[model samples]
Structures are given as structure tokens and as C-alpha cells.
Target chain A: MSQSLDTRSSPGATPGEGPDATRQASPAWRRLARLALRQREVSIFLAGVLLVLYFQFSNSAFLSTDNLANLVQFSATTAIIAAGEVFVLVSGELDLSVGMVYALTPFVMFFAAGAGLPVGLAVIVGLLAAGAVGLVNGVVTTVLGLPAFVTTLGTLFLVNGLTLTISGGFPVQPTASGTFTSLFGASPLAELGWAVLLALVLQFVLNKTRWGLHTIGTGGNPVGAAEVGIKVRLIKTGNFVLCAALGGFAGVLDAFRIGSIDPLAGGNDIMFAAMAAAVIGGTLLTGGSGTVIGALLGAAVLGILKDGFTLLGVSAYTFDMILGAAILVTMAINVRLSIWRDQGEG
Target chain B: MADASTGRELLRAEHIAKNYGQVTALTDINLRIDRGEVLGLLGDNGAGKSTLMKIFTGFVKPSSGQLHFDGKPVELSSVSHARSLGIEAVYQDLALINELNVYRNMFLQREPVKGRFLGILDDKKMRAAAIEQLDRMGVRIPSVDVPVAKLSGGQRQGIAVARSVYQKARLLLLDEPTAAMGAKESALILDVIQRLKDEGEMGIIIIAHNYAQIFDVCDRVNLVEGGRIVFDKKTSETSVEELTDMVVREYREARRSVQAG
Candidate 1:
């Protein structure tokens, strides 16, 4: 860094001299390489492409439309949950109870169905139940001044236990009509489109809405945000609620697809995937930066990895190793961009 | 406009004092800023200018004081409440979120909304307004799209001033705006201060140690010594040398008294 500064301050360049006279009159290819390095999202996208190509090369069945659609369906729930988690992550907080909420919401809807309520009403109640859990998480973390990790971790086990006690550790099939099934996860359209649509809307909200802008500001500088009259606590708590609601929505959708709501359907594995997807999408674990489309692409990368491994007859344990390596390499690029950003360069 | 000649009061702080447990931070701080005037508050490291400013800005409640704004005595509930009453503070840190873009930081909490439900931000309007404010401040930058982290120290200060200005604040409290900048950077900020001073409607209180800068942008100056106002004079009436001489003499007398005691 010191050497670069010294070079930048060197006295070789002069006024009225053309661009060629500058010290940075290196090859165009070198400049192009720097540009590629700076565009972290493009690099991540290309990596995803290469992964897809590798899978295609490995098995001809990998690129089949039927198989691709199946892969999207498999990745849909994780991707959806990840899209919401991006909000919480960008706000510099974590929501560990999302997986537990995921399990609880569907059971809530199932209980509603058993009570002879309409399926639509049951789903709304389930989503609201998830939102309530999110509210508790938010209040405990922000209002009570507890750390988000500790608060959500406590709720994670508490919610899971509540779900187990309520459901008596049993799986109950949910009644669903054609419209409801097609809208959530059972039909062909819902399976692939829900994740993509949610990702698009969430990305729009994060980038183009006042709520999104405030969320970023609140996460980026809580003190500054408060100084500017932003209700930082409200934004953070709202983000937690939104994230949990999305998680519940994913679980409900999955329940409709599977035709049964299990007490132990979404566990630690689901939470881990959702968080990994958010990170893979380039949402900073350190907060103050995030991307919704990045989360979708990250889900795609993971989906491809899993489907490819399954087809190649690779064990699930090796799957974690390769996935971890891929995430490390992509995240290295993200860290580089962040470091340059901190150096006050555009 | 209020008559500056007759000493019209835009804000008046009467007998403000702050005590933190056993430590008396500030006592006997009586100050007032007239409309369309710049009041330079000169103080050393612990002379309590900041404490007074914080009290005035509602960040810290005075132990005993009465603040009358526009002739109304009101207790400010919080910093936001003070801001609602048109009191804004620009800290040396600028209090900008470095992770957000220039336009985003400019509109941090006060975003323009257009959508019916949930009020989506009118980003187009915000971007144009940010550009206009920066242009008015003479803050040249590549674009308002980059995060504030990409800006220089001087540019950040200009943006901070611009943010307060755009908020239409009545009394701006600037804490060391030109503290850590190069000659050219400081001159640029000085230009901005001069611009604001020329607005002739808002009151500004600048806390700084730079004597030359105090004379350059301020119409009136106050010397704060030992948590109290030692001298107050208009710029046209007092020279920088007089203020510096008084400060030197006061320091010597204090040292002698301490040694004798």
C-alpha cells in the first residue's frame, strides 16, 4: 500500500501531457484485468457459469430442462429464505431463529386447517405467527439491548421446542387446492418462479425504496442514522420481522409441495444454507453492504453444486469441502473490493 | 428579517450548566446567537464549548438552564426534537455513513418518497437534489453514486454541511469543520462557510481554534475560558491579535495562581 502511494505521488506526470505520459500508461489488458477484478458481481456470475459448464461437461443430463427445473425447485426455498436474510445480514444483525420459525409456521397453518379454517386464512395466520417470532427477536435484540446473535440463538431452540410440543413430534398433511398449490410450491410455476420473483422484488426494495435505503443507512452507521432522525430500532426490527416472515413463507410453500408438514422439517441445515446463500450473494457478513440478486445467483451456484455432486455419485461430506472452497475464492474477491473501497477509491 | 443592528435574538441560552456526578463540566455558560450572524466560540481543549453546544443541541440536557428559541421556552426531548426545532450539529467526524452512496448519505433519514404503499424512495429526485446541493457547496466529485467512503476529508465535510443546509436548519452548530485539512481543503471549506454566512437568515455557531478563520467567517466572536464567557465582541470591533493576547495573558495568570496556591 505504501509503495502504491509513493508511485501515485511521484513527479513524473505533468500538466498538458497526454494520458500516455502518465506512470499508469501500462498495457490496456492490465487495466482491463483491474476492471474485471473490481466488478465483484460479474466475477461471481462468471464463476457460476463455469460451475454450470463443468457440470454439463461431467454429465449430459445436467443441462436438461427437466433436470434444471428440478434443480430450481430444490433451490427455491433456501433461495427465498436467503433473499429475506440479506436484509437482516446487511443491517449488521443475524436471525438464527428463521429455521425454527420455518418449522413452526407450517405447523401453525396445519393447525389452522385442522380447526376448519380456510387455507388462505391459515397461511396468513402462519405468516403472522412467523412475524410475531420475528418481532420478539427484534425487541429482545434492539429494545432490550441484547446482542442479535444471542437473542436469536435463544429463540431458535425455544421456537423449535414449541413446534415439537405443539405438533407432538408428528407429521400432518396439509390440505391444498389447485390455486394455492400453484401459487406456493406444488405446481410447476410456483417451484421455480417464487424464488426468482421474491429475489427481484427484494432487490428492488433494497436498491430503489426508502425503506431499503434507510435499512442500509441504519446498518451502515447507526449513530449517523440516529443523528439524521432515522428510527434505527424500527428499521432493524422491521428487517428481522421481514426475514422471519420470508422464512415462514418458504416453509409453508415447501409444506404444500411435500403435502405434509413435519415438526422437524427445517432444522440447522436449512438455516446454514440460507446464511451461506446470503453470503455467497456478496452480502457482507460485516454489514453495511448487500445484494439480493447476488443471493439468487449464490443459490444457483449451490444448487448446481449439489445436483452435480449427486449425479457424479460424490458423497455429501465432500460436497461441503468443495462448496467451502468455492465460497472462499468468491469471498476473497469481495474482500478485495471492500478493502479498495475503504481506501477511498471509486 | 430580524434586525441584527438592534441585537435580535434567534436563540438565547440563559445560565446553562452541566455537572456529571462530581465533575463539573460546564458552569455559567450564557450565550446567544442573533439571526443572520456567525458566532465564533473560541476555547481550548476542555473549555466547555462542546458541552455548551451539546446542551444547546439537546444531546446533553443542561443541569440548570433556560433555552428560548423564537421567544419560546421549550425542553427538547432528544436530539431529533432539537432538530425539529431547527437545531443541527455538524461534528468533526461529519457523522456520515461511509458505506452508503453520496445521495443516500445526503438523504439518510429524510428520504423523498413517491410510491403509494410503503413510500418507495424517489431516487431520481434525491440524486438530482444531492447533485444540486454539492454543486452549491462547490464540492466537486466524480458522481453521487459512489459510497461516501470514496470521498476525501474535505469533500466529506462539505457534504456534512450540505446535509444540514438541505435540512433547512435554523441554527447550525459546526464543531471543528476545518480542523484537519490541507491549506487548499481548509480554504474550500472556508468558501462554503462564507457562502452560508452570506445567507443572512440562519444562525451559526462555530467552535474552532483557528483565529484567522474565526475572523474570516464570523461576524461576532466569544472567548470561552474556564467554562465561562470571558469576552464577546463583533468582528469589526476586535482584532485577532487582541483575542490571542487576552488568551495568552489569561493562561499566564492561571499558571501563576496555580503555582502560588
Candidate 2:
């Protein structure tokens, strides 16, 4: 880094003046490449890729087309949920109710479908129920001036209780509607469900929209955002709504993919893993800086790691411990890197 | 026509008073700012300078008295109301989002949208306008895309100034704009204030503790003690030594009164 800086600052470095000028002109591209390489998401992605390569060399079944497809299929739900978590995390807030909301969504759909409602409308209604819960959580946090963690925690338990009561502690197996089940549960096309499509669209919106910019700004500096007339409250509210809506959609996808709606379908472990993926991907808990792509990459890394560990004959309990430790170590490294970067710039 | 001859007072605060429960923050404060003049508000710490400025910027409401804008009595309910009437403030912190690039920060609240349908932020136009405004003020930043956090302190201040001016602020209130700045940056800011004065169409109220700065940039200086205007004099008619004496005298008298009570 020091060498590059020195070269950029050397004499006769003016654009179009000398050989150094050519290098100076390419600084923007070089800087972009450096940024991509330095991104925490990229590092996690490389780790996932390396893990996959190692597993494939060790076990022939690991690289089989069927296993690879199954891996992607398994990761799809986690990726969708983590994508939603990214918005909440970036806005300097958290949603603990997401796991409960995820569990409740499938129940809502199954009941709606049983009550003579069409599969599509039932799914929509289920999503709306999740969104409504999210809205309640957001209003509770913002209007009541409660900490998001506390507010969402209350909602988490409330939703979980409601789901258990509705299901009567029993799993419901809906007669899979041919079109709906095929769209979200089948082989090749299942990979392209509403959850995955929504994730892609959300990633785009988070990067390319005015709303995204304001969310980042509000998280980074709410006071500054308010002073500049960015309407921090509105931005935060929108982020909450987006997160809830996505979490609800992920819940619907889970119902279709799993072919059954269980009371404990989306347990605490799913929420924990989603959050871990987001943090490991580079979304700081303190907020202000993060990317949706980073969350997806983090999800991919975790999924690959889990799959690779299983292939390598690692015990399930040991794998869980290792995953938890890896998340902690990655988070610590991220913080150290951020501090070093800030100090170097200063 | 008569109002035009009188230059139509832009801002007037009459008998303004503020209190925080049992504590009196300001008392019987009366002031007026006219178009194209710099009103230097000078006060020591705890002298209600910040209180008055907050009321002016609609950050706080006075417990008593009325604020009038453009010769009409009005209540500024929020900062947006103040901004809509061309009142812009540059607080001590500058209130700029440091993570954003210069163009985005400058037009944060008022970004120009482009295209006919599905309009997106007109980055090209905003960048051009930002560069033009900064260049006009002799501010030279390396790139408009650089986040403000990476910029120098002086450069950040310059961006704040540029933002206020770009918004076509008619009444600019700068609260200790030079307090934390070095001599050169402060001088640059002072030059910008002077240039705004030369434009002769906007009113400026600068709050500063430094007598030298007030003297250098202000047309008239209003000295406040105990939330009341103890002295208001033309900068040309007053000496720095006399202003210092008045401030010291005001402080001592307040202290003596407290001691007596």
C-alpha cells in the first residue's frame, strides 16, 4: 500500500506527461480492484471457494451435480432471510422476531390454504401477516422509543406463542398445490423461487436506490441525516418494513420447500445463523457501512463450510462449535481491519 | 415602496424569553436583522448566545415574545419551516454526513432528480453544480466523489458553506463557524462571509466569541448580557478594547449580582 501511494505521488506523475502519467490515469481502476479485494465479503467468498475445492478433492460426492444443486437449494432460504437481515443491520437495528415470523408464515399459509383460499392468495396473506408483525415491531421501536432489541424480542416470543397456539403443537402437511409446489419445491426451477428472485431485486435496490443511500446515511449519522433533511425517521421505518416483508417472503418459501409447516420450522438457530452470516459478510453491528452482496456471500460461506465439514466427516456438534468460533474470529478481524484502515488514513 | 426604502427587516425577535423549567435561559431579548448586513452576535459562555440562535433556527421555541420574518409575524414550527423561508444555519459541528461524497452531501435534502419517467438522482447535474459553487468560492477539493470524512477540516467547512449558499439561503446564521478552525481556514471562511455581504441581497447573523473576528467581518456588533442586548454599535464606531471592556464589565456585574443575592 505504501509503495503504491509513493508511486502515485512521485514527480512527473501528471496525467499525459510521462510514463508515470499512464499509471496515474489507471489509478481509478486500480483503486476499484483494491476495494473489491479488500472487501470482507470477498475474503469470506474466497474462503468458501477454497473450502469447496478442498472437499471436492477429498471426496468425489462433494462435487457431484446433485450435491451441488442440493447445496444451493439448502442455502436459498438462509440467503433470503440473511438478505432481509442485512437491511435491518445496516439501519443500526435488529429484528429478533424474524425467526418466529418465519415459523408463523408457513402456518398462516397452510391454514389459509385449508380454509378454501387459493394457494397464491394464501401465500400472499401469509406474507402480509409477517409484514404486519414487522410493521408492529417497527412502530413499537420508533414510536414508543424502545430499543429495537427489546421491542423485537417481545415480538419474537409473542409470534412464537401465537404460532404454537395456532398449530396446536402439531405439524400441518398441506396437499401441495401442483403449481405452487412445482414453482418453489421442484428441482431446477425451485432454485428460482420468489425468495431468490426477491433477494436479487433487494440487492439491486439496496445498492442503486435513493432509499438505500438514505438508510446507510441514517445509520452512519442520524443527526447529520436529520440536519440535511433526509428524514431519518422515514428511512428507518422503510428499512423496517423492507426487512419484515422479506422475512415474511422467506417464511412462505420455507413452507413450500419443506412440504410441511412445523411450529418450530424457523427456530432460534436460523436467526442466529442469519445474523452470523450478515456480520461475517461485513455488515457491522454498529451499522453505517455494509452491503447486501456481503450478506449473501456470508451466507454462501457458512453454507459451504457446513457442507464441507459434513463431507469431511466432522461431527455435527463439533461443526456447530467451529461455526460459532469462526464467526467470532471473523468479526474480531473485521473490527481490527476497520481500526487499522481508519488509523492509516488518519 | 416605503417598506423597500426601509429595506424590509428580514428577521425580528421581540422581547424573546426562554426558560428551562426553573432556570431562565434568556430574557427580554430583542434583535433585528436587515437584508445585506452582517449582524455579529457577541456573548460569553452562558450568555444566552446559543439559546437565541437556537430560537432563530427553530431548534427551540422561546417561552415569550414573537419572531417575525420579512416584516410579518410568524412562528417557525420546525427547522424545515426556517429553511423554506431561506434561513440556513451552519452550526459549530457543520452537520454534514461524513460518509457521503461531496455532491451527495451538498444536495442531500434537495437532490436534483433527472429523466422524465422513473427519475433518478441527477448525479451529473449535481456534481457539476457542486463543483461550480465550490469553484466560485475558491474551494479546491481533489474529487467531488470523495467522502467528506476524508476531507480536511477546512474543506469540510467549505462544503458546509457551499451547501448553505447553493440552497439560496437569504438569512445565513453561522454559529462559531471559525471556532475550531486554524487561522488560514478561518480567514477563508471570513472571506466567504464578506463575499456574501457584497452580494447585498442576503442577511447574515454570525455568532462568535472572538472579538477580532466579529470586528473583521461584521457590520454591527450586538453585545448580550443576561439574555438582553446590553450594547449594539456599529463596528466602525467601536474599538476592540472598548468591546472587551464592555464584555468584562457585563460579566463582573452579573457575578456581583449573583454574589449579592
Candidate 3:
């Protein structure tokens, strides 16, 4: 252990300088750099790079501007959802209703638009409907002290039932009006503009705000955070609400992208995909540590794999099996990298 | 040893009692901690050491008791209330997020922010402050940027100690700070405790099962048994053997009573 500590020490100390003196005099900058790279994220990032290169090699189409644009567009939808899931995960909670919430958002927007509601009002109402579901989820979880998984699972069914009951179990199509379609799902900039913008904003909030710190703290150690005067319950409740809103927003984006709202827009498969993206990006299911950028990268990796496989004419049925395998492998690699990093530090 | 005559008492607990459902967890516990003194709370598992500390830190409201902080009667209704009054508890778990680096963990919930509205976390200021705080505590690590999950148990504990000190915690409650540490690492932690004592009149309540450690750094030792204080004596006035005997005797008596019932 002493030998390892010595090896890990900063390079400025003279060769014969005593260990105690070396420890006492080491510079702070060197230490900070060491801390930044000594985690699973760095390793996962490297793996993501390797995957990108391998896919690019296998298919000449992989690196084309058009494919890259499509890849970003595809990832934008899932990345937005995952960004919110990051909050829920960081608060040591989960929202299984996100998938159902995603399915219900478009219907709310469609009905609002059909009622002659202004686009802005319709958007607000749609967001509010999602926020309300999130609020209920948060209240039930925090006030009643129920585990987030069970509460959100119940909400999943509840939201799904509501969507079915409202839509009469049928798909809802928007008027295809230029303004309505453009705001909801139009790609005027020739890419997923709103989706990308939302992802970036969420990323900024996660990385730069007080809410981000509290979310991380709540997930990392609830008891410790509480002792430090952090309102763990409040942070967690806020995360659930935020996550629901994001999921709902993603649903709106999806509806606009497709120009229609299916009763099963984002079914269980998308939830699995989002989870895979998050976990593969280094967000542990156990919570306390995650990054929006990592999730975005993870989503990109998945998007590339799926798109590439489909472009190569791989069967859709086989894609599921491939995705399942990919998720398992990525998660296994992430776990191993974390363990290795931990061992290296000690 | 310095004279105990100068500093004022910072915390006092009177007839503190707590019950969990039907079972009594702690009973009639009385203790006093003066500024700049380290008081060791010693007991084996299930000896109500944790319960006493919990009550002091407001994790569990005492069914009945009076807790006085800074000579004022205070009701610690929540952990935040206790912390706002300069009380901070460092549990054995260290409660650090493995994914966050030292500065982030140190300033976790109470991050220093800049600006009027949507004040951003002052990362530069926080990082500098975390370095200063840990350095003052005599803790040397590779970096503050690495996630704490990568740190050794000793390093992690050091971060926790640094956090409490950074918060200007007047009364620090450490629950087995060095329980799983090696001899060298444990000694390093003891050095931190000594530094804290000299730097400020920060009263500390250290809960530990290790008698040697407790005896080495503590000014006084309080032995708890069967949810009550069985012996409270100055460390210099008491021998380790006597302390061991008191613990063993309490254990046997408690076991006998349980068997008899």
C-alpha cells in the first residue's frame, strides 16, 4: 500500500525525499487531474470511441454526413428522455412511467390543438398534464414513502390506461398544419432541432446548477446528505417531477417527428433502450453518479448500432436480440471498468 | 494536557431517553461536552451508543429529554436544524457519493454559488476551498477531481472529516471514523482529531469500539451499557483494564437478565 501511494504521488518530489514530505508538499492541480480521469466514465468513453470506429470500418456509410446527422437525430429523442432519467437515477429513484408518459404526451397536445387551443397553450397544457402525473408520482413516493419503482410502475399502468381511455385506443393525427407540425415535430433545420436543444439545456442544468449537486448527493448518500442539511426528500421529489416532464417532452417530440401519436409510441422496448443507454454510459442503476453527456454518448452508440444494422438489412427481430446482447456487454464492461478504477486508486 | 477550566460547555444532554416502538433504545442518558474537547462514547454493539448519538444529532427524536446547544435549550427536530446549529455527524459509511470527486462531495448539498438569480456553483472557489480544508486537516490525496469511489477507506474518511471541519462544525459527531482502518491510517485520523482540537474550540463526540484509540485522543470517556451511561470518567484517571472490565461486567449482567426473563 505504501509503495502504491508512493508511485501515485506527484512527480515534483525529489527521488530521495521522504514519503511524509512528498505527501505534505504535493501540488493540488496534479491531484485534481488524477481525480477527473480515475472513474468508469473515462473508460466507457474510450469504449464508445472504439465502437464508433469499428462500426465505421464495417460500413462505409457509417461516417457519412447524412448518416451522422440521422444518428444525432435518432439519439436526440432518447437522449432527452435519458437526461431526465439521469435525474431520477441520481436521486436514487426510477420512473417506469416514463415510457407510458411518453406515449400520453402527444395525445394531450393533439387534443389541445383540436380544441382550437393556441399552440402555446396546447404545449403548456401537454407539459402540465405530464407534470401533473410527475407531481402525483413525486407526492406518492415522498409523502407515502413508497419505493419509486413500485409507484412509477403503478403510474405506468395508470397513464397508459388514461391514454387508451382518452384516445379510444386509436392513433391520433395532427392537422399537419405548417405551424402545428413545425413546432411539434417539423425538422426545418434539417435535423432534430428542439430535441437536440432540450438535451443540451438539460445537460447544462445537470452540470451547472444547485439542483444537480443535490440530486447527486441525494443519490450518493441520502443519510449523509440529510445530515449536511440537504433536503433529500425534496430533491428526490423534484427529480421525479423533472423526469416526468422530460419524458413527456420526448413524447411530444416523437409525435411531431412521426406526425402522429400512437397509443404505444414509446413502449417497453424504448424504456429498455433508454435504460441500456444510461447504464452503458456509466450511470449505475444503484444511482449517485451519472452524466448527461455520458448518457448522450450511450444513446449515440445505441443509435449507431441499430441504424447501421438496419441499413445493412438485418432483420428487425434480430435487432432486438442484438440490442439485448449489446446492452449486456456494455453494462458488463462498465462494471469491470469501475472495479478496475477502484482497485487502481486504492 | 490542557486545563479544562477555560472553554465554555458547548453541548449538554439531560435525561435523554428514546424508545423504538415497545423497546427502550436509550434511557436517562446524561452527558456534557465542552468546547475544544474530544469526548469518546465507547460501547459494544447494541449498547445504545448509536441511539445516543442519533438523538444528539436529531436522527431520532428522544421520547423524552432536553438537549442544550451553546447553553441554550434546543429542540433538534430535524438533521438540518441540528446542522444549522453547527452539529454534524460523520457516520462510518462516510455518506460520500463514489462518483463525485472530493470538491463536489465536500460541497455536495451546500455548494458555494455565485450571482443573484440562478447563482451558479462557484466551482473554482469550491475546489480551492476543498483543497485548503483538506490540507489543513493534514489529509493528502492524489486529487480532488477523482470520484471518491476511487479513494481508499481511509481517504474517504479523511474527506468526511474535512467536510465537517469545512462546514465549521462546532460539535462534530463521528460514528466509528476509523473502525475499518489500518493502524497507520487510524493514526493519521487521530492526528486530524488533534489538529481540530487545537484549531478551534470544536467539541467532538467520537463513538468507537476501539479502546486504545478512544483512550489515546479523548479527554474523557463515557461507557454506555443497557441504554444508559454506566461509567463516565476522565481518560487520564482511568485504566484500559478497568474500562474493559466495566464493559464485560455490563455485558454479562445484561445477558443474564435476558436469559432470566
TM-score, every prediction: 0.90, 0.89, 0.85
Candidates ranked, most accurate by TM-score first: 1, 2, 3
> Candidate 2 — which residues are off by over 4 angstroms?
A1-40, A192-196, B1-5, B114-119, B254-261
State the DockQ of every prediction. Answer: 0.66, 0.47, 0.46
lDDT of all predictions, in order shown?
A: 0.83, 0.78, 0.79
**lDDT top scorer:** 1
List, residue by residue over B32-99, the lDDT tens digit for candidate 2: 88899999999888889999988988889999999989888989898888889999998878878766
In the range A1-346, model 3's lDDT, one tens digit per residue, is 5643453333323234533443454445335324534443554455556667777788888888778767766677787788788888878998888888889887898899888998667877888899889898998998999998899989999999999999999897766567666666556343367655766776667778788877887888887777666888888888888888888888877787677789977966666677777777778788787877777777777887787887778998998898887777666545543443444445
Better of 2 and 3 by DockQ: 2
What ranges in model 1 sit over 4 Å off?
Answer: A1-40, A340-346, B1-7, B71-77, B210-213, B236-242, B245-261
Model 3: colliding residue pairs: A31-B142, A31-B143, A35-B145, A35-B146, A185-A256
Each model: TM-score of chain B? 0.92, 0.91, 0.92
Model 1 CAPRI quality: medium
Better of 1 and 3 by lDDT: 1
lDDT, candidate 2, at B198: 90
Superpose all Cα atoms of candidate 2 onto the true structure and report the RMSD in Å to 1 decimal: 6.2
